[model samples]
Target: MTTKVFTIQPNKRLRAVEEIMKWAHVRHVPVVDERGRLVGIVSHRDLMGAAISTLQVRISEVERLQHNAAVEVRQLMHFPTATIGPDERVQRAAHLMRSLKIGCLPVLEDQHLVGIVTEADLLHIVEELPDASLALRI
Candidate 1:
């Protein structure tokens, strides 16, 4: 889980979200309300979907920027997001992500957004195990 999670507001432009994701080198970002409560989540996949849904195959870069600028985070974020508690075992997080077909799970504590657990994080755990090869085998 990443404690230094980057978050965005619902009303922010998708362009800003893309900028943050690119600059931070992160694929997922949590959305928060005015009081910092978790509201939604947006992933790189979501950004691509939004762009593809609105743009033509041969659109120019400028047109892409305009489309992203016109859309808000709320328009693309996944709401009522599946979340995991900090105290839960990593296996639970992994199971939820796999069963739900999500790339990440927001970590919540007392209903507050605390961190996030992503597939990469789980892979890191697997890599660190003494018998990592055995775990990876089908």
Candidate 2:
């Protein structure tokens, strides 16, 4: 799990979110409220969907920037998101992500956003196992 997670506010523009994602090299970002409570989640897939919807035509970079600026994080974020506790086993996090068809799970502690577990994190665990080949076999 990533303890030093990057977060965004609901009122922020999608362009800001995109910039953060690019700068941080992260695909998933948690949304927090004024009190720093977890509110929603945003992913690369959400950004792509928003881009496709807004740029139906081949638009210039300036036009794309304008559209992104007009859209807020709340408009594309997944609210009331599924979350996991920090104390929970990694297997539980993996199961929840798989069952929910989500790419990541926000880690909460005492109702506060503490960290995040992503598909890449799980893959890293698999990669570190002594018998990783066996685990990967169908």
Candidate 3:
């Protein structure tokens, strides 16, 4: 089903990202600037990547903070984000994900971030072949 989706603005601080993750229980957030233009995408892993290498911060402190920790989202986000349009078929999404080695796709319409689709979304579509045992000739 085609639909619009979650988005965040660039002016929003890192703490906002943390809160969004907590409230929505989502791994990624699409970033739009003040003008409603998509600028980047941030994921939980991206935050973790930064947290892991924070030299001054004790590693234990990061672990203790857990998912609730609020850091600057922009500090950990990936820019020039990859995107797909809503009209695109699921197959294209799968192909792009595999080829690009990415975990999620931000659906866009007219350069605006729309719904997000991940590998998990596609997994539900996999169907078993009927009579697979009979077709097998090992």
Candidate 4:
């Protein structure tokens, strides 16, 4: 899990979100409210999906500009997000993510965003397991 999580405001433009994602090298960003509560989540897949849907209509500069200008984080985010408590077991978090078919989960405490756990994190954990070397031996 990464404690140093990057977040975004709901009102920010989709173009700004794309820039942030690129610069920060993060695929998922949690959306926070004024009180710093996790409200929603946006993923790189969401942006690409939206763009693809629009392009399927007609690929035009004017249409692209309109799409970029009109879209906001609030409109693109996945709402009622599934989250995990920071104290929860990694296995539990992993299970939830698998069942939900989500790539990541925002870690929260008292409804405030604290961290984020992704499939990458789980992969790291698996690699560090005590018996990880056994697979190579066999």
Best by TM-score: 2
Off by over 4 Å in 1: 52-55, 132-135
Model 2 regions lying over 4 Å from their true place: 52-55, 132-135
Instruction: Flag clash pairs in model 1.
Output: none
**Candidate 4 lDDT by residue in tens digits, 1-138:** 899998999998787778888999988989999999998998999888766455367677787767777788898898745888988999899899999899999999998999999898999998888884548654
Give the TM-score of each candidate.
Answer: 0.91, 0.92, 0.71, 0.85
- Sort all candidates by lDDT, best to worst: 1, 2, 4, 3
lDDT to native, each model: 0.90, 0.90, 0.70, 0.86
Q: lDDT tens string, model 2, 76-122?
A: 99974589999999999999999989899999899899999999999
Task: Kindly give the number of clashing pairs for every candidate.
Answer: 0, 0, 2, 0
- Which tens-of-lDDT digit does each residue in 20-100 have in candidate 3? 877877777788787767788888777666554447555675564563344555666787446889899988999998998
Measured over all alpha carbons after superposition, the RMSD of each candidate to the real structure, in angstroms, is 2.0, 1.9, 4.7, 2.7
lDDT of 3 at 1: 23
Off by over 4 Å in 3: 1-4, 52-71, 127-138
Error of 3 at 52 (Å): 5.5
lDDT of 1 by residue, 82-126 (tens): 899999999999999999899999999999999999999998998
Model 3 TM-score, 2 decimals: 0.71
lDDT of 2: 0.90
Predicted structure 1: lDDT: 0.90
